[model samples]
Every structure is written in C-alpha cells, then in structure tokens.
Target chain A: MSRSVTANLKTKYLVMTKKVIFIILALYTFSSWSYAGGGWPVPKGGFYFKLSEWWLISDRHYTDAGQIDPNITSGIFNTSIYTEYGLTNRLGLVVYFPFLSRAYVNNVVSGTTGDLLIAGDAINTIGDTDIGLKYSLTPQGSIKTAVTLTLGLPLGNSSGGSQQNLQTGDGEFNQMLSFDAGTSFSTKRVTFYTNVMMGVNNRTNDFSDEFRYGLEFGAGFLDRKIWIVGRLTGVESFKNGATAAQVNSTSIFANNSEYTSYGAELSYYLTSKIGFNVGYASAFRGELIFANPSYTVGVFLDFTK
Target chain B: MNIFSRAILWAIVWSFLSCIGDDIIDDRVDPVLRITNAIDTMEINTNYTFEALFLNHVGKEEVITLEWNTSDPDLMRIDPDGNATALAVGVVRIGVKGIAPSGEAVQDEVPCVIGNSTVNNLKERKAIVKTTSSYLLEGDAVLQEMEGGFLKLSLAENYKASTALPGLYVYLTNNPNTTAGAYEIGAVSVFSGAHDYELPSEVKLTDYDYLLYYCKPFNVKVGDGKFED
Candidate 1:
C-alpha cells in the first residue's frame, strides 16, 4: 500500500455521519493491539512473527457514572507473542499467546504509627491466549478487506492472587468476529493510509459481551522507509455482567472491563526484513478497568516479504 | 530516527513526567475529630469538659488547639478551655474543633441536657467489647442515647486493634457472621487509644446485639463484641 489512492472509493455505497460515528465508538473499546499491517494479508506460505510488551499502572478508575475516582493502585505487565501463517492467498491462521502476565498493587501505610494499614499482594501467571482464522476478500479497486474469527482460551491464572480482584484472567471462554477495511493513497514523498475494524464479542462467563472497534491513520514517507500511525480504539459492554456488589466478593473477576483509548505507533525499518514497532495507549474514559495509559514495544520478523 | 519515533518518544517521556499522581492515592481515612467522653445528658449547673479522645490524619497533636463552642450560648456556655456550664433549662450542643499544623480541621458535637428528667430520654452505659475472633479488639465502648437526638459510640482509653488489617468497618449488627442486617457505622477511622462515632437517631441499639469490626472489601469478619450493660 505504498501508493496514494482515494480512500473514499466506497462513498457512493456508504455514508459517514456524526450519529453513525458516535454509535460505532460508543459500542466498542480497545483491548488488544497486535499484528498491525498496511491493508495487506500475509502472503501465501508466508510466516510473520511478532513479540511485544505492554505495561499498565492505575491508581484510579472511572465509576459507573463515568466519573473518575480513586481506587486500588493496580499494576499489570504483559509480554505477548503473535504468529500468522498464510495457508492460501486468501486464507491465514493466527495465534496469540501472552506468556508472562503479572499483577500487583500498592500498600496503604499508616501515617500515625509508620505501619502498614493495608496489605498488598503480587501475582504472576500466563494470560489468556487466542487463536483465529483470517480470510481475505478479493480486492475491489483499491479497497482491501478481511474477516477474522477468533477464540479466546482461558489458559491464564484467574484465581492465583490473594484477593479476588487481583486475578490475571477472567476464567471464561470467549468468541470474537471482526471485519477490517483499509485504503491507501500516495503523494510525491509520502503515502497515506487508513484502516478500521469492527467486531463483536461473546463470553461464556457472566462477564458481559461487547462491541469492539478500531480506527488507524498513518503515512509512509521517503519511499516507504518510515510509517507513522495514530490509532483510536473502543469497547462497550452489554451491561449484563455481574457487578462486584452483586457477586460474593470472593468470586468477582474482570466481568465488564471496558475502555475508550487512543494512541500513537511508530515503525522504523532498520532493514527490509526487520523493523521496530513501539506504541503507547491510554484509556481516557472507561468502566471496570484501569483508567491509565499502557506502553508497548515490539520487534517483528517478516521473512516472506 | 523516523519523525514518528521521535514524536512517540517525546509523548512517552511527557506522559511519565506528568504521571506524578502515580504514587499519590487517596486511600487514607479523612481527618476526623472523635470525642469519647460525650454524654447524652448533663444535670443543670453541672460542669462538663469537652475533649477529643482520638484525632485522625494528624501526625503531631501537641501543636493543634482544641477549641469548644456551643449551639445555644444562652442555654450553655463553653469556656476557652472547653468547659461547659449549663445555663437555662433548655437543650444545647457542645462543639469541639481542632486544627492541625497541616491546616486540616476535624470537628464534632454532642448534646448536653439542661432540663428536667421528664423530657430527657438520655441514657449512658459502659459495655466491654471483647474480640470474638483472633484479631485484637479490646476496649470499653460508651453507648449513649442523647435526650435531644442521636446516639454516641466511643472506645475506651485502653483500646487497640491489629494494625495489619485493611478496610475495617464498624457496624451495629445482629448477626456477626454476616453484615446482612446491620447499621453501618462507617469505616473504622481509629485503631488505638480512644475514638468516638456519632450515629443517627434512626438506628436503635436495642435492634442489634453485637458490635462488629469487619473488613468490607475482603468480606471477612475480623471480630465482634456483644453489647452488655
């Protein structure tokens, strides 16, 4: 997608409105960011490998009423790996595994006696993994599209921490289906591209299912030597999940984690086959989730290209 | 050395620099002024000294001045030293305020009787609250129902609880095993020495038998003490 082309190729078939945009953003949030590309599927028989790390620490959370309020000082770290293999020109298999996930929080100390007033615990375990199949559709003019179906496996520790809220995983199987669309256009020195995804999630636990959405816009400069991107992602729960007050304190997990986040990503190619990807994202508005930013850095290997 | 990487690096660095609230958490209980010696009624012409047994959120208590005032100065007079002298035959409130060197203030008030015994529903009793569980909770709680309105709960001079527990709450409950039917007295603001909490008149002591100390977030019952005359 190094050439600049009209992104409004489907304007005659679709309309973009404030009402429609708000409806889409309000229904979904960003939970994961992986295997980003320039509207291109993995070539047939091609293999792509990516490794990334994300860090989050939040001392506050958004309330049910959408107000920011102080809460436990929670910290989480995730190191994830993702792989995609192109089985056919239009078909691919993807796997995501977060091998190392950690959770902890700060302690409250008594100012009077210099003693600990509240205790804190640290827990480390594997995070939930996902496997999916992505099928690319035949391109229409300059527009590229793909659909993916993913399955979330409860392979992480959901009951490891001393407190019920400290668990790393939600202990529930989930299914998600997504549609992705992207287009690219080029100027004399830079090529501009835009990508968007919409998805639906289903869960087995009482945790709420959700609608998910993402939009990314970027540019490739100096003969595709550098790609700079900005991203917006969101998720909205169905409001049907069990709340902490509704469940026994010992049994409550991350039932309805939701957030609307925006971030920036940079990809620098040191060589044609190897590049560095770094990103930082934060939840400006959220419910039942950490209300702070997260950081990510990854290295990619694209041998087939 | 792409412009995007440079821009992202600056953004990340700026975000870290602005995350100063990263370490600041508002988990501590608010500064409170608890007067353990509060009484429901005082005989006319009786002198009562208003004092705070527990002061929370203040590191140094020696520099803070405890000042006293009255709701009805005509019915009761409070001296600069917090001594109250009953005046006319009417109800009045004795208030105490203490401002720490840190500029934080904690204040409280209790009613004093200045009338005949007929309209006075005021009664005060001492109950020994022993720990029901393994946690350390030993103290004398002064239970008083004011003639004017409301009730007061206080810890004795020699009172203490385990310092390791978090999110501890005090409740007037019939069942200590569960907070199912309990009048929430709010979180425990003080753990040692003496402290006092004022309850609304809606909660009757006769409705519950046990005074419970519970961990609300963890849903664990630390200990309990039954009210006995």
Candidate 2:
C-alpha cells in the first residue's frame, strides 16, 4: 500500500511538471520571433513577422592575434524585416531582408591646426539578404530537432565612399546548413528552454568558409507575459581565403573574420499577437572583427496564437 | 497610433540618426632645428655656407632666423648668417639655435675638424622599424641619397609585416604621431623580405625624420622608424 502511494505521488508530480512545460512551450512559440525557428516549426498556415533595426558603431577592432587595436570610428546601421511562414506542419520558409542599410566613417581632423585631414563619407543601399527553408525532424518527441538550409545573397554596396573603404556587405554569395536541437523543462513557477545549433557556411568569391555554433537559453516569467533570452553565437574561419596583401584592396572588410558574441534580449508582450523586444550583444573574443557592441530594437507579430 | 505605423516611424528615426561626425587626433611633436647641410671636415682657409631647417611644434616647416655658434672661436668663426670659416687646424662643434612660434627654443650641433678637404656628411641613414600597435611590424629601413638627387628607401631582407592589414602604406614625415604633413610614398605591396621604394628627385634626404607605416583607408598608424645615424 505504501509503494502504491509513492508511485501515485510521482505520477502526479510528473503531470504537474508537464503542464508547466506545455504552458512554456505555448508562450515561446510566439516569443522566438527575433531568432526565429529554433527547434520548432510553426503550425500550418501560421506566420511570424518582425520589423527591426540593428546597428554597430566601432572605433576599434580585433587583430589577427585576437588583440584590440584602434581604428577609425565607423558605423553601420540596418533596417530589416524578418519573417517565417509555415508551408506545412513540419516545413517552414524564412526570410531576412534589410531593405535599407547605411555605413559611415568619421571625419579626421588635425588636433594642432584644426584642419580637416580626411573628409567623412557615407553610403546608403540595400543590405545582404537571407532566404532559408527549415524542416522539423522530430514532430512529437520530448527534444525537438530541426535542419535548415539558408542562402545568403549579396545585395548591398560592397565598396563605396570616396576611398572605397565603406561597405554594407561582404560582397559574397554563401550557403549555410544548420542543425538545431532543443529541450524544455520547468521549475515550480518558472519555465525554461535551451537550444544548441551548429552549422557550416560555404562562401564564394575568394572569401573563406566558416563553422558556426550557438547556444541559447530562455525563461518565461510573470505568468508567461514576459520572456528573457540569452545566447552565445560563434564563428570560426577556415582561413583558406586570399590575404589582404593578395587582394590588394584598401577595404577593411577583408576575408577570414571570426567572433564569439554573447547577447541578451528582453521581450514584452502587450497582447498575445503583438510584442516588443530590445537586445544588446558584444564580442568577448574576436579576430579581424569589430571590438564593440551591437544593438537591436524591434516589434513582432505572431499569428500562431 | 497603430503598432505598424509606430514601427515605421521608428525605422525612419533610426535611419536619420546616423550622421557624419568628427574625430580629433593629437598630432603634436617637439620642435626641432636641423642642420640640413653639415660637413664632416672643413678645409683650412675655406668658407662654407650652412643651411638650417626649423620645424614647429606640429612638425611643420617654418621660416625662422637661426643664430650660429662655434664651440671654440680659435678654431672656427661663424657669422649670424651661418657662414663659417676655419681659422686653425683643430676640431670644433658647429651649433645652431632657433625660437619657434610657440616660444620653444630648439637647437642642433655637429662636430667638424679642419682637414685637407671638406667632406659632406654621411649620405645614408639607417633606422630600426618597430610596431607601435598590436600588429606585427618590424624591419630595418635604410634611407640613402641616390644619383640625380633622388632618395631611395630600402627595406632589408629581415623585414616582415602583417599581411592582414589593409591599405598599408609607407610615408616620410617629420612628425611620428600623424600623417598630416607627411609625404606618402605608396602602398606597400611587399609583406616580407627586401624591397626598394624610389622617391622623386625633389624629396631631399633630410626632409623627414621618421618613416611611418600607416593604413591609408583606416587612417591609423601601425609602426614608425626614426632616421638614426
């Protein structure tokens, strides 16, 4: 009789935990608009859309030895739209398009004479775009797995400004194949989920290929009205591209750049279908990349609810 | 207003927020007075007209009146205009001093001996280049006066630089801090080993004091080599 009671209590505890996990999953189905389609595909005919602005202004950069060195103050801003639409229950289409992008450099002025040494320059154009298709491999498992194939299109100005130093894109076409696996669990009151992703990006036009990886963890709070997400994304170059000396260009957007960045996002849902998000990310270790933080602000709409 | 309209407004505001700004750099250096045409030996009973160049606090050449001085009046006599005459068979230090616009006094001195015939100073200057940043830049640079009054900058075979830097260019400048008044040589096509850069005939051997390695597009200094003995 005592053994039976213990078994019944264990079953009851599992049922309660499962209920919490379900509620968390339901909340996150609409919350992953910023980094869309982590491990789950949207329901059939459902859609998610976001309008965002991302920017980075840096006066320093990381050298090939992973050391920081000062550079001219430069800024790049992109106004983009990200969307995911479910073609079927297990297949989804993803698109990330920056309709407007701008890059600028600061004017260099002489400290002694107060004369302009180099005039500042700016360029405005469409940024690079990404189109992808994601398919869920696990439909009813406790841990979900998905695979995505993405194609990167070079659409922005690769070289601009008077000195041809300003750029909005890397001017290369590439493709990436990624795999994501995620799981969810719940405590007494808070619900949490974690996802891991790995990918291989094959690049063209003398640009080096890259190996990408990421880990993301998120929690739902305030009765699932607000969610906080933390992520670490990294890229490692293959170092097979032509060197700057070989290319013979003055552009700072050379090949073989790598960085490992950590970011946090705060998302608040005003309604079930409408929400807002703000995020900040910075690299703690990098090479041939900017040694600065980037910012993002966006509003998203989820039709899955 | 509605959410979509508010989102559109935000995008427009972000687009307009990006504007060109200014970056001020500290490019000041100590003023210097250099004897451009100094001789190692002076002939007895011969007069030589010396020339001096005064560089201001910012390393810009400025016209200033120089006062010439001889360490021993018995060995050599110098006038206010830098015209010097050897008096006896001895050695003396020829010195020149000038006051810059910023009220800073600068001076230079060179020793000379009264010998059989006057000989010009060494025609070749050498310097060891070292990195000022995190980049890998180290080399031995030689500046020599070539025929036809041209200058030749030669990098030794031990020279090596980081090929990761873009738009790496070499320049000759009086100031080591910036390229404001520097004469750009050209882009550096050689990353390692020996290379030679031929300067125009108008570029004098004493025109600059430092060999600066800079990134033209990034507008940052990588390394510098002082013109030593």
Candidate 3:
C-alpha cells in the first residue's frame, strides 16, 4: 500500500512538471509572437509591429585573384521582432530585437586542406538591437520620405567563436544614419510600392564603417490579401586596421569584402491583420566573402491602436 | 472659430513644416565616400591589381577617375591607365586621387617596396605540341601509332608567374627536325581526336615539357625541358 502511494505521488509530480513546462513553452511562444508580429512605420500616425526573418545567402567566397567561386556559398540567418510607436503624424520611435545564426563553408581553393568551416550556435538573445527615431521629411499624398537616426547597442553574444565570419554581433557600439524613401501607386486590382533605404554604419576596431543600401519592390494581389516582394541589397565595408601579426597571418582574408544580395518573398494575409511571409535570397556575387543562399519564414500581425 | 484658436492652429502647421525642412536638410548632406580598397604597405614587385567600383551614386561611372602618383617618381610610376611600373628598387609612397563626378577629389596614399629582380637572363619561350598524324588511345597503357614528331615547349616550369595582368602565347610547330632553335608554326587547328596519343617506344619520355599551372593574377612561366611534377 505504501509503494502504491509512492507511485501515485511520483505520477503527480511528473504531471505537475509537464504542466509547468507546457505553460512555459506556451508563454515563450506567445511572447515571441507578440514581439515579432507587429510594427512597420506607417504613414502619418499608426503604431506598427513586424517580426521578420532575413536569410543572407552567398557570402561570396572568391579565389586569391578575386574571382567568384560558384561552388563556395554561405550566409547568416536573422530573426527580428520590432515595434514602432508613432509619437506624432510625422514622427515615430522604434525598438528591435534580433537573433542570428551564422554558418559558412569554403570550397573555392583546390584540395580539402584550404576548406573554410564556420558554424556557430544560434544567438537568441538580444543582439545589436537598434533604437531609432524616424521623422518624415517629405510627405506627399502618394510619396513619402523619412530619415532615421539609430543607436545600435552590442547586447548580444559578441564573442561566441572566432569562426563567426557570420557574426551575430559586431562586438561594438554603432550608430547608423539612414534615409528611407517610398512611393506607392494603386489601381483597381493591384497596388505597387517601392522603397529605397540607405544606411551609414559607424563601428569600432573589430569592425569598420560600412554603407548599406537596399531597394524593396512589392505588389499586392488578390484584393490586397497576397503580396509578392523582391529586394536587392548591397553592402560595402571599410577595412579595419590590422595589427602586424594579423597582416602576417594568412588565415584572415580581410581585404575588400563586398556583397550584394537579391531575393523574392511571398506573403499572404489570412485576415486584415495577420499574415505569413517566406523568402529566398542568394548572394549573386561578392569579393572576400562566403558563398551560399539563405532562406526565411515568418508570421506577422499588424494593427493600429 | 475664435481668433486665438485660429492662431494656435496656424502655429501647429508651421511647426510641422519646419520639421519637414529639417529632415530634408539632413538627407541632402554629401554622402561620405570611403575607399575600402586602400593598401597600407605594398611591395612594388609583388604585382598587385585591385578594382575600384563606385557605390551609392549610380549611373556615374564616367564621373570618377582614379589618378595614382608615387612619392618617388624615379622609383615607381603609375600611369593614368592604372598601370604601376617599377623604376628602381626602392621604397615609395603611392597616392591615388579619386575624382568624383562633381569635380570633388579625394586622395589616399600608401607606402610600397619595389624589389629588384636579381636574375635577368630569363627568356620568354613558346611551345606547340602536335601529333604528326591522327592518334588514338584504345585503353590505358595501350599503343596507337601515328606520324613521328617532336613537341616544342613554349614555357619553362621554373619561371615565376605574374600575379597581376598576365599575357600568354600559344602556337603549334610542324618542323620535327629543328628541335634546338625557336620555330614558329602556322595556323593551329584544334579538334577532337579519334583516340589519345600513346608514347612511342623509341622516344624518351623525359624530354617532354610539363604544363605550368597558375592561380589568377599570377603569371607562370615554365622552365626549359622541366616538368611541373
């Protein structure tokens, strides 16, 4: 009888633990959904939130002569949840949290000896989160342009492994000044929109200043319920000052790493406020970079209060 | 509306306009043009060539021209065509002037060493190896007989290859008797052979020249009568 009681107690304890674990998982999922599901800076005055996954494909591995190797490909995966609060019709504030996974393989050179391998754990913590203030400079009926000043804080795992050419965090504080210009035209059945963004990044020793520019084009379909989008992004970085030993070390290919990516995304809205998005991106070509393609899947909820 | 309320509304409108003006001003600032490909210390004889591509500003390829100058023009000289020639064995400062489309110019400089070539007796050679007649390979280590001829080697394996811009000469020779002197062959035609050529029993294999392999930007020259292996 005592053994039976003990067994019953054990069963109860297991049930309680399972319940707790289930609750914890549900809460975590809910929180992530809330974080990523909303916010895009809209025209004039509405709070917006967006959760997005960006996959960087084709880091662009090249031969010593700077010729691109088609076989060598790699990239990073980033999941970001951001929210924007409209202070006024013309001004807004935004906060974003990002998680990253960086992986790569090098197959450019002959022989298996020169193979470059880079893999790291997922950085789910807040990485170089950006807090920014955006204000509309020009607001026409159909066209609008905005300027943003953002402060990027190194709050994520900056130093996980030396192999992280796919670094989750740049390990330094940075400031980015950006400009975004967008325009939209709609007909009875379709809506067409395009946005161009340019950013200037200021970084520290382990990092360098960079210029990032991108163009996003999209069209809404099926009574504005489905959207197909294409984007082209390019980045150019200045070289950091290397120490004498670093210059002598042949492991690091630190000269002129430039990359460009092109991608297409399909998004479907289930309701007026909820949607799912998936995308595929590839680095068309690059120098001193990895080579590969990246993919993204995300769900979003958008609303205004 | 009362006069006071009307005045407050106008003030709000004016404030909004001022904010818009400020934002435009921020966006109009000249974009910082940073040269990411500047070299700090370059060896003169190292033969390095890099490209400068314009970014941010589109459709303005002609607007930017790169002008390079050396600190010691006697030691090194850079042509307007982006060619760097070593004048003497010495250290020199190399400066690149970037002329923007707007007539604005930016300059960057670096130090470089030009090494002197100690061996000057290197001769450029070209070789063409052709079968005297159609040859075939039935299987591995099998023999397919054809017309007998000697192969002329174009490059020696021991010569250092140029890493930068490289030039290659390939030709075919028909004269089998002239093996000691440089012989030029007429129009060479390339086609798929019915069978691969087999080594002749009378001819020694050690006299054959091996092909030289080189990575890009580096020029490779093969030495006389030397095999790459």
Candidate topping lDDT: 2
How many backbone overlaps does candidate 1 show? 8
The first chain of model 3 has a TM-score of 0.68
* Fraction of native A-B contacts kept, per candidate: 0.02, 0.80, 0.00
In CAPRI terms, model 2 is classed as medium
Deviation in Å, model 2, residue B209 alpha carbon = 0.9
* Model 2 segments more than 4 A misplaced: A1-36, A187-189, A252-254, B43-47, B72-79, B85-89
- In angstroms, how far off is A293's CA in candidate 2? 1.2
Worst 10 residues of 3 chain A by lDDT: A21-30
True lDDT of residue B152, candidate 2 = 95
Task: Give the DockQ (2 decimals) of all models.
Answer: 0.06, 0.62, 0.01
> Per-residue alpha-carbon lDDT of model 2 for A185-283, expressed as tens digits?
766666677778788889898778888787767776765557777778778889887777787685435578888878787777677667777877888
Compare candidates 1 and 3 on DockQ and give the better one. 1
**Model 1: CAPRI class:** incorrect
Which wins on lDDT, candidate 1 or candidate 3? 1
Q: Model 2 clash pairs?
A: none
lDDT of 3 by residue, A1-305 (tens): 00011111112223332110000000011011111111123334554455555544443344324455332233344556656666775576767666433332322231212222122222233455667776767643335567777777766544343333224454557677777666655567766666677777676544447676777666667765776767677667665534212322221222334667676767776666555666666666655444455555555555442
Worst 10 residues of 1 chain A by lDDT: A17-26
lDDT by residue (B50-79, candidate 1, tens digit) is 666333442112435778899999888988
What TM-score would chain A of each candidate receive against the reference chain A? 0.85, 0.88, 0.68
